[model samples]
Target: MSQLANDSRVQVRKKSKERSKFFWGMVYLAPALILMSVFIFYPVLKTIYYSFYYTNNRGIPVTFAGLDNFINLFTSESFLISMRGTFLYVLYTVPLGVVIALFLAVISSEKIRAIGIFRVIFSSTMGVSVAAGSMMFLFLFHPTIGFLNHIIGLVGISPIHWLTDPKWALISIAATSIWMGIGFNYIILLSGLQNIPEDMYEAAKIDGAGYFTRLFKITIPLVSPTLFFVIIVTVIHSFQSFGQIDILTQGGPAESTNLIVYSIYQNAFIHTKYGLASAQAIILFVIILIITIIQFKVGEKKVHYQ
Candidate 1:
């Protein structure tokens, strides 16, 4: 009887200690939970709720809209154009940005004097804010006094209307995006390159492997994980791009550059169509989620983790 009581007492004490630890853990987690609940979870739930109703200018849902908002969005020509532009922007920005950054990273990773200076210069754009970069590009794209036009004129080519022409507006913004994105991608790829074991390259050299052969077989496979991460993040950033387009074109030139996010912004703020905007937001969220999931599914096969 005494041993049984002692064992029971010990078990009770262990349970009490677990309960005490759990209580303190909750106490420590309270602030983060509260912040996420208020800022992230609540807003997401509210957006999903608002998406299925007609909202006033104040964003209060006044009537049940069912699937009408989504239906209308699919059938609307402007929304279709915005969708096309968004995908095209994604296609334009992601591959070029990744390739250029990877090339810079590879070249800058060379063991030479002043390589750190080159790295700093390459990644300097990471310090520039989006607003500032957009403004700089805005000046560069200006028709009359722009440096770009001046250079073209020196070559006896006609000065181009970069942001004003429908054909060039999206491409111009895409170029600005690629330039601005290079700093971040370069930094990341450089880090990945530096993380690669030098011994691997030494072994490849001993095998009489040429530079291009070793690069294709070793460097790419080793950096595949980082490359995959950069691609995913760049795609997401491309989809959510807005500030540059807003400053450079304002969805003008016949709405050729009216991306999905900008279209949502116009609906919510400019047109006082909160419900439609929320619906668009939800669609964007779904699209991003689907794309991310697909990337994880398909791209993970190629990611080599060491």
Candidate 2:
């Protein structure tokens, strides 16, 4: 009977200790929770609230504008052009980024010497600032004096106005974006490639699978999770592309390359149409959210975590 009583006391003590530990854990996490609520959650709610109101030259006039701003945005020709440009930007950037990154990852994963040095060389571009990189590309693609045009001259072709010509301006920006982004994606895919088991490749080789077959049938499937992650992130970043457009094109040659985010910036800061800008921002947020959710739904089926 005494032993039974002692065991019950020990159980009670353990339960008390567990409760104490949980209490302390909550205490440790409180600061982070508070910070997130203040910085992230509050800003989101405030932005949504501000989207419904109109602001004038004096200040923000807290009167609801209903769907007027949204209606105006959709009806505007510039908005339409911006939307088209933004879509083109995302479409080209995401797939190209993924494919190039995957290719580089495969090459880097090979049994080659100085792998670390090669890795650094490939990823070095990621460290360059967006504005600086865009400006560099601008000079490199200059019509007559550009290095690229000089090379093309040897091939019996005239200089291309990469940035000044409307048709070529968007393409130029896309190329610069790809060059700047490929390095980061390559590093991500390289990490994923390294995590894949060597034995799997050996097994495939023993089964008479060629390199391309193994890559398509085995490597791709195993790395699908990482690939999906990279795609989603790349898509989001592409949608938010502003620095390149601002520095290189400035929505130039006829606002041909004006993207949605840049348009919002112009409306808000340049035009001082805060309410209109907020509405545009809200629309952008919704579009991104819907697209991201769709991607998650579609990609979840294909991702092979194992």
RMSD, every candidate, angstroms? 1.4, 2.8
Write the residue-wise lDDT of candidate 1 on 116-226 in tens digits. Answer: 999999999999988999999999999999999999999999999999999999999999999999999999999999999999999999999999998899999999999
Error of 1 at 217 (Å): 1.6
Model 1, residue 227: C-alpha shift (Å): 1.0
lDDT of each: 0.95, 0.89
* Residue 63 accuracy (lDDT) in model 2: 79
List, residue by residue over 51-73, the lDDT tens digit for candidate 2.
77787855475678888888888
Candidate 2: lDDT over CA atoms? 0.89
Estimate the TM-score of every prediction.
0.96, 0.91
> Evaluated with TM-score, which candidate comes out highest?
1
Q: Which segments of candidate 2 are over 4 A away from where they belong? A: 1-23
